[model samples]
Target: MTDIIEAIERVNGVLVDLSLEAFENDWQRQWLVERGVEIISEASRHLPDDLKARNPEIPWQKVAGIGNVLRHNYENIAAAVLWKLAQADLSTLEKACRSELAAEQSRGRR
Candidate 1:
């Protein structure tokens, strides 16, 4: 959960400085964001089903599958898709991660 939150924060930090045009034009930023997504996706897979069920609003399966796409189909990923993910999905994912973490902590689960 902390990994997911940290990954989102890292991507958000990069996105603050980039427009879609700049994000597309810069390979480094694209890679950084993609890597962050991979981390988020991988960590999300380890979350218990009940915890994820608490937030059905989040697309948990899609979140887990994203890393597979990044790993296997990375060459075909569009810059706009990545940009949209950063702009849109990231904040929602961050909120879900934080909420789940807090819930776990309150339950006395480390």
Candidate 2:
């Protein structure tokens, strides 16, 4: 659980540092967008099903699927889509991860 939270936090931090403008350059797209997706995909793969179940809003399957796409079909991936996902979609997952961490901490203190 802590590992999941930590992973999410790390990805969130990386996403925070990125911007859509970075996708304009081919190198930036490969380094930032592609690598970021790879990191998130690996992190998401390690997340427990029980924890994932708690966050209904997140498309857990799609999250995992993106990783597969990036890994298997790297050439087909769109930088703009990845950029959109990083800027918009990730915040929801990050918020859910933080909420779960807070709930866990509260339970621990009790």
Candidate 3:
């Protein structure tokens, strides 16, 4: 929810200016993005199924699995993968989060 949206914004903010070459070389930026993904991954697990159903495009299982990767197999993650995710995949996820939040607010109003 809000956590996921905020984390994505934080990560996207960090990456909005950097290129793949720069992202690969900057360990600090990579760490920040990884941390954000970890937050998104953990928060995603608690999302309601009905909310998830509305955005079937998101790879919800992979979203959860990434936290495990960050925790247990940290060495396996590459900078390129992180760059691609931040640049390409995160917007879709962020959009889903916003959509879910809006839907929840609409339901609350009713």
Candidate 4:
């Protein structure tokens, strides 16, 4: 659906924004990581459990963990961890989102 696609686009846009060097500095990284967490939470909320299960390529738990960290323990959140997530996990998440969208579209057609 268009809604899912829109959500993916929004997530990608924020990911792109966060990937920029300006967002990497200590002054801005936490805010960017928070924003990243927000984007992942919004996008993940749109995905049905069945779809998520079918697509094991996505790290759903980690996606949810961002919100948990930001909400409950943000004061002790680590920059290195956030940076590692940005570098390591975001692309996989983005790809999984696109794949799920495609699968949903195919299911609708059938």
Question: Using TM-score as the measure, which candidate wins?
Answer: 3
Instruction: List model 4 lDDT by residue over 3-109, tens digit each.
Output: 43454454455556464455446555456556656667666766778877877877777776667777778878766666666667666766766776687689999
Alpha-carbon local distance difference test for all models? 0.91, 0.71, 0.93, 0.64
Q: Which one wins by lDDT: 1 or 2? A: 1
Off by over 4 Å in 4: 1-24, 106-110
User: lDDT tens string, model 1, 1-110?
Assistant: 99999989999999896789988999999999999999999999999988888889899999999999999999999989999998998899899888877877888954
Residue 30's C-alpha lDDT in candidate 2? Answer: 55
Score residue 82 of candidate 1 by CA lDDT. Answer: 91
lDDT (tens digit, per residue) of candidate 3 on 16-93: 878999999999999999999999999999999988888999999999999999899988999999998888899999
Clashes of each: 0, 0, 0, 0
Give candidate 2 misplaced runs (Cα > 4 Å): 1-22
lDDT of 1 at 36: 97
Error of 3 at 19 (Å): 0.6
Please state every model's RMSD to the true fold in angstroms. 1.7, 2.9, 0.9, 3.7
For candidate 3, give the lDDT.
0.93
Ranking by TM-score: 3, 1, 2, 4
lDDT measured at residue 41 in model 3 versus the true structure, 0 to 100: 98
The candidate with the higher lDDT, 2 or 3, is 3
Instruction: Pull out the clashing pairs in model 1.
Output: none
Candidate number that wins on TM-score, 2 or 3: 3
